[model samples]
Structure formats: structure tokens, C-alpha cells
Target: MKGNTNKIIWLTGASSGIGEALAYELSHKGYKLIISARNEKQLILVKEKCKYPENVAVLPLDLAGFSTVGNGVKIAIAIYGRIDILINNAGISQRSLIMETGLEVYEKLIIVNYLGTVALTKEVLPHFISKKSGQFVTVTSLMGKFGSPYRSGYCAAKHALHGFFDVLRMEHDKDGIDVTLVCPGFVQTKVAINALIGDGSSQNRNDTATEQGMPAEIFARKMIRAIEQKKYEVYIGGKEIKGIYLKRFFPNLLHKIVLRSQYR
Candidate 1:
């Protein structure tokens, strides 16, 4: 992959999982990284694990607090001079059926997963536009393309990202701003355990499918390659990733298969 050593990349949700893994991958490739998450200590730990710790900065942020994201980006720009890439990887998930889910739970998931990401993207966009060069790498999900049982809110949030970022890519393409939406089928992240339940409570337990999902490091490496190629959208995972195409080309068969899948 082509390395952009001078590019400054700002990544959220860097405390663990795919975000942390990407920090290591990108840092090793020589990109200056600014990592953010609500967990300050964990963000520091991620920075320490980077090949070039001196090139990584830890910025703790809570995506749920969308109003403050602009200030956070301002602080990051102050430190890095300019941000060449914005990776919106911070998001929450839902692990309950819609009927069993509370309205507040749905709203919270939307706020953290969709709205917060959009807000942060908007915050960094002006800088990109002025410079006429930047990339926005969004970590959505395969759920964005196909709805699954027990994840109505998560599916909704992920689907919304597609609509939002797709438009951003079209509107800003001429400005040299590229947007890549990454939809992974099942990633072995703590997402399942951290997923919100119907009553707005954490599941606090990993699901079987998630346990068998792709490793974060492997996922991150593929993502880096996709970003380098400037692909507008890419799907990554194991066999499950094939569902994206199946869902598009053979809806009925895909529906039947998904309905009978053990992951549901």
C-alpha cells in the first residue's frame, strides 16, 4: 500500500477493537495519528502500542456528546496543523428487537451511532474543503445493507450512515474529498458485549457470531489497503460479507438464508 507519511489522520473509537488495530497499522505505515475515544487511559495505552508512539496523540472524546466534537477537532488541528483523513469509527450497537426496545434506547443509539458520526464529519469537513484534499473513512456495517433479527435499531443507524455519507461523497468529490464507507459483516470486536439492550442497558456479553468474527488486526489491514486505493465503498469479513451482494442481487434467497442463519 502507498504510505502517506506526512498525512495527519484523526480516528475516533481508538480505545480498542478495529480502531486500536488501525492505529497500529497506520502508525507503522508512517501516518501521523490522532486517536480518540471516551476512555482516556485506554487511548493512552493504544498510543503506547503504536510503532511510533511519538507520532500518535491520544484525544479522549465521547461521541454521545455531539455538541463538543467540533472543539475536539479544533484541538486536534491545533496539534497536527491539518487533518488529512477523518475516520469515523466510533459507534454504539443495538442487540434487541424493535418491539422490545424503548424509544429512548433507539434515540440513544441513533445519537451515538449516526448523529455523532455525522457531526464529527461535518466538523472536519470545512478544513478539508479549504485544503481541497482529504478523506473520510466511515466504519458502517453489513447491517446497513441488510436488516437482521434482534438488531432493528442497529440496522437503522447503520443504514442512515449510508444515506448521509453517500451524499457527502457526491457533493464533495470535486473538492478532492473522498469518502469510503466500510461495511464489515462480523468483526471480533467488543461491540456485541457493549451493545445496548431493549431497555437501554448494556448486553455485557459477546454473541456467538461475534466470537467467530474476523480479527480486528486483519480487518484493519484490509481497510488500510482499501483506503489507499480510494475505493468509495468496500465490504470485508468472511463468508458473511458475500451477503451484501446476495442481498442486492437475490433478495428473496438472501432473506431466506438470513432468516434461517444461526447468527440471528
Candidate 2:
């Protein structure tokens, strides 16, 4: 399976961080890729850095622009004839208290992280159903399973993703569609620096935990292995991954631990 080069993947948020890392890894494995993000230049740069640049195509996509997703999907399909997998990795993080966060901020979070992903998935669903074999690998966050301070809107958006994708898997498994929800904890990326603040502006700073988290390359390797294995769900991170179990078995303890940590 690792040697199969015919598989084509459409990966969103391919310009940076985990998406960028995933692009490089997939290219190394000889998968044809159509990479997308709002930043065309960054996407091109990422594609150029891949091991097999010839196997990569760039498609600039803005998840917030839901109306354009149909056209985008058409363009993506034109590049590869069919998309074997759709990686929903483009999303924004937040670093604001709920009370201070504006309604607009929450709306943008929902649009980009939840609704936009849903829109893209819906656009691709028909094609996947027609093919009777396709994968939806969504990159959510550990926050999706539990809560944290200063990430109220972000958590809510990620939480919604879990709900939507879970149902998608249940509804489409008969069609041979697979859904893998990858919930990542902090990684050494610009996510913290680029996170949205209370007024919808970028946070413009890094969080301590994020700076000290696992490197993107390492995280991508583990994630790719999970994808190759076709796991239904995988949580990748440091000790933070344990939060999933904590949330399940000891909600109060998890709350106390999260409150004490006060991560931003």
C-alpha cells in the first residue's frame, strides 16, 4: 500500500504547519496531490518543497467562501480525474475568552472551521459516492473532545466538526467512504501566533505549550501512518493526548487540570 502511487489526494490548508508537513510526506510516498489554501504563493512554495513536485498541483481555496467550493471541487477533480482522499485541515484557532469574544469572531470560527469544512465535504460527497471508495481525513483538535481556557470559540468549532464527521462516517460507510478524524494537540507551529483574538484580529504571539510541543515533521509522520492504516480516529500529541481519556473517565479532574494549566 505504501508503494501505491496512483492515489490522488486533495488537501486543504496545505500552505503551512501540519498541512504543509503532510503534503511533503504524501509526496514522498508518491501520492498525487492537489494542495489548496487561501495563499496561492504559499501553496506553490509548499508544492515546490515536496519530494515529487511534479506530482503536486496547487489550488488556492478559501474555506470561508462556501459558494466557490463547488467550482473548486470541479477544478480539483479536473487535475486528478478523481480524488481518493479529501483532507480537511484548513482551520483557524482562537485565543480569547468567550465573554470578550465578539459575535463576529465566533461566526468566522464557525464558518471556517465547521461550516466551510462541511461545505467542501458535501461538494465532494457525490463524487465519493459515485466512486464508492474515498477517504475523508479531517484534522480537528484535542479541544474538540474537551474544553480549555481562552479557546471557547475555537473549541466550539472543533467540537462541531466531530459531530458532523461522525455522522458522515455512519451515513457513508455503506458506500465505502472512510472518515478519519485526527485530533491533534499542540504542535510547534504558527497556530498560536495566528490564532484569533477577541475582536477577530490575529493573536500575533505564540503560546508556551505550543512552542514546546511536538515538531510538525514528527507529528506528520505519525499522522501519515495513521492515515495509511485507515484508523477511524487518532489523537496525536504529547501528554495532552491523555486528555481524551481524562475527559471520558474523570471530567472533573480534567477540568481541574485544564484550569490549573491555564494554557492560551
Candidate 3:
């Protein structure tokens, strides 16, 4: 995965944040990229910023729109004949309490963050199975490791990703398929501002924690190393990443801190 000139990598949510940073990082490594996002214009900007702009293509995709995911997959395949890796980075966050949130927001989160990712992977599964070589990379969050304030739905969706991908890795191991579940604690991205509120509207404001989180470029550099090493699971971020380990060795300690932690 390092300095591979012909490898094809398809990535969703490439319009901004970690995905955008990855476009540049992988481009520098000389990988052909099929970058997708709901915004074609922003995708184009990402492609232009790539080290090898000619090797990148903008594939507009809407994960929430199941009907369009398959088409996007086909177009991505058309770009490089086949994809060596698929990065599921397309997701939305939540920024409201469970009681204040509506059922519709939870449903949308499941649809886009969980089902949509699964659907895209399935569309590309046949290709990977036939070749018996490919990687599935998902960008989950630290919240996936433990429940947190103001993110019940987001946490549920990410936790579901862990369950689904663990099964995928186990079932496909014999087929030589690799899965990397990346749990990022937090990064300086617009995730907080774009998070859905109780009424299913965007939060429209960035939180202090997000403003001071790790830069997406640094996070992407570390991510590329983990991907190249073919890690099954890894966590990246600031001190918050420690929460994952704490949850494992000291459940009660983690539980107490998480409940009182004001993520916003």
C-alpha cells in the first residue's frame, strides 16, 4: 500500500476532512483514487489538490441514497478497472441528547452511517472475492467504544459498524480479504457543525473540543501507516483515545467518566 503506483483506492466522503487529507496522502504515494462525496464540486477540489491530479477522479455519491450507491461503485470500478481498497469514510454525527432527539434522526443515521456503508461494500464484494485480494477500511469513532453524552444515535451506528465488520473480517479471512476498523477519537473537522440535532437539523456550530482536536492531515498520515501495515483495528487521536483502553481494563472507571463528560 506504500508507493504503489497501480493500486486503486476508492474512498467515500472525500470532499473534506480526513477523506480529503487521505486523497492528498495517497496521491503522494502514487495510488489511483476514485474519490466520492455528495458534493461533486468539493470532490473536484480534492482531486485538484492531489499530488497526482491526473490519477484522481471525482465520483459523486450520496450514501444516504441507497439507489445511487451501486451506480457510484460501478463508476469507480470503471475508472481503474478494479479497486484494491475501499475506504468507508462517509458518515454524519449527532449533537443532541437521546430524549431530545427524534426517531427520524436515528433512522437516518442507521441508513447513512450503517446500511449505506454496508451496501457499498456489498456492491464491491464480488470483485474482491474474485481477485481474493482487497481491503475494507472504515472510519468509526471513539464513541463506538463506549456510550457518550449527546451522541447516542451516532454511537449506536458506529457500534453497529464494529459488529458488521468484525463478522466480515471473520467470514472473509479465508478469502484473503482484509478489514481495518479505524476509531478516531476526534479531529479538527466540521463533523460537529454538520452533526444532526434533535430535529434532524445540522448543529450549525463547532464545539470547543473539535476546534482543538488533532489536525486531519496528521491523522491521515498515521492512518496510512496503519493501513499499509494491514492492522485489523486501530484507534487514533488525542488523550481521548485512551478511553478505549480504559474501557477494557477498567470498565467502571470509564463508565463513570463517560457519563459525566460533556462532549460538547
Candidate 4:
């Protein structure tokens, strides 16, 4: 699907941050887009800002509420006849230690970050299988590759995404199904401010590293290139991208460095 301007892309979490930037970029490239988020109003605002506002459709979705996902998928397909790509970008972050976090917090994390994405994917899987061509671009985090402080549940959910999508690529390669796992280290966004804390409430604060990380627009550009190339996976960020290699070849050293780092 590289260089295909007619492709239809359904992007979640399009109301803000990286997703918003991606919507703008993709729409500018002449691709039809269906932007989704829990807030329909914000989704509309984002659509208006796109290069081709008339080509952008807003579909509000609640990832935590999986029961409505099937119908949502149906509506998404109807919007553009079929979706060429599904960008799984909707997920919540965590900013609490495991010891103090509530069970419900972890449950919400898994539901929104893992189960919700899986449910949506399952709903769309049959269509892909029928057509024998589709793409799933999941916006996981660098935490998916390794650990970090104040993000135990977030890390677990992201790591789960890697596992699930990896197997998906393996099982559906023959069907022409493509899975691209995008791991982002730190992007200047509201993710940290919206992160859940021990009491199941938003952290409501910005993170130092996140504020200083790469711009969401820049990350979006790189991410789209990777998607166009149909890469199996790609990591986007500043120096923090090195953590992936550090974890792979120097586990103990990475662990020590993580403990001493101030990013959390």
C-alpha cells in the first residue's frame, strides 16, 4: 500500500498528541481518514484542522467500553466502504507504583490498553481475512520493550500488545495481513498529564522527559514513513530509543540505569 493516496485509515486517539499529528499528516497526503476518540467534539475539531477536512470523518469511541466496539467497527467500515489500515493509538498511561496501585487501576489499564484494542482488532479481523489485505498499526510504547518507574501497569499492557501483534503477524502473513508495532519513547504530549495514579485518578501533571522529548509532529512524520514501508516495527524518540538495544544486549546494565534515571 505504499504511496497509495486512496487508502482509508481509521485512527484512534485522534483528538490530541501524536494521533492528531498523524491525522493531519495522513490527510494532507490525500488518504481518507476516520478519526476517533471518546470526545466527539474534539474529534470534530481535529477533523476541521486537517488538510482535507471534508475527507475526514469523526467516530467517537470509548476503548474502555468494549461492548460497543463491534458496532463501532461496522460504522467505521460503512464510512469508507472498507478500512485499509487501523491505527490503534488509543490507550491510557499510568504513573503509579505497583505496590500502591489499586486492582481496578490495573484492570482499567488492561481493558483500555490491551483488551480494548484486541476486541476492536477481532471485530475487524474477519473483514481483513475476507479481503486478504489489511494493516494494523499499533502505537505501543518503548515501555513495551522494557520497564520503568511509575508505569508498571502501562508497561505490562504495552508489552502485551507486542506479544499479541507479533503472533498476529506470524499467523496472518499468508493472508496478506500486516502488523506494524510502533514503539514511541517520549513524545511531547498530554499522556503524562492524563496518566492514572494509585487512586485511579489522573496524574494531572506533565513529565519532565515527556515535555522535553521529540515533537509529536516530527514523530508522526517518521511514523508514517515506517507505516508506508510496512515495517514490522519501529522505535521513535530521542536518545531513549537506545534503551531498546540496551535492554536486548545489556539487561543488567539497563536495569541499573533505569533505576538511576530521572525520566519517570
Every candidate's CA RMSD: 1.5, 1.1, 1.3, 1.5
Candidate 3 displacement at residue 102 in angstroms: 0.6
Whole-model Cα lDDT of every candidate shown, in order? 0.91, 0.94, 0.92, 0.94
Q: After superposition, how far is residue 41 of candidate 4 from its true place, in Å?
A: 0.3
Model 4 clash pairs are: none
The local lDDT score (0 to 100) that residue 131 gets in candidate 1 is 96
CA deviation > 4 Å runs, candidate 4: 1-3
Error of 2 at 125 (Å): 0.4
User: Cα RMSD (Å) between model 3 and the true structure?
Assistant: 1.3
Tens-digit lDDT track of model 3 for 124-206: 98889999999999999998888788999999999999999999999999989999999997899999999999999999999
Per-residue alpha-carbon lDDT of model 1 for 120-238, expressed as tens digits? 99999999999999999999999999988888888999999999999999999999999999998788999999999999999999998999999999999999999988899999999
Estimated TM-score per prediction? 0.97, 0.98, 0.97, 0.98
**Candidate 2: what lDDT?**
0.94
Give candidate 1's TM-score. 0.97
Q: Name the TM-score of candidate 4.
A: 0.98
Please write out the lDDT profile of model 4 over residues 9-123, one tens digit for every residue.
9999999999999999998888899999999999999999998899899999998888999999999999989999999999999998889999999999999999999999999
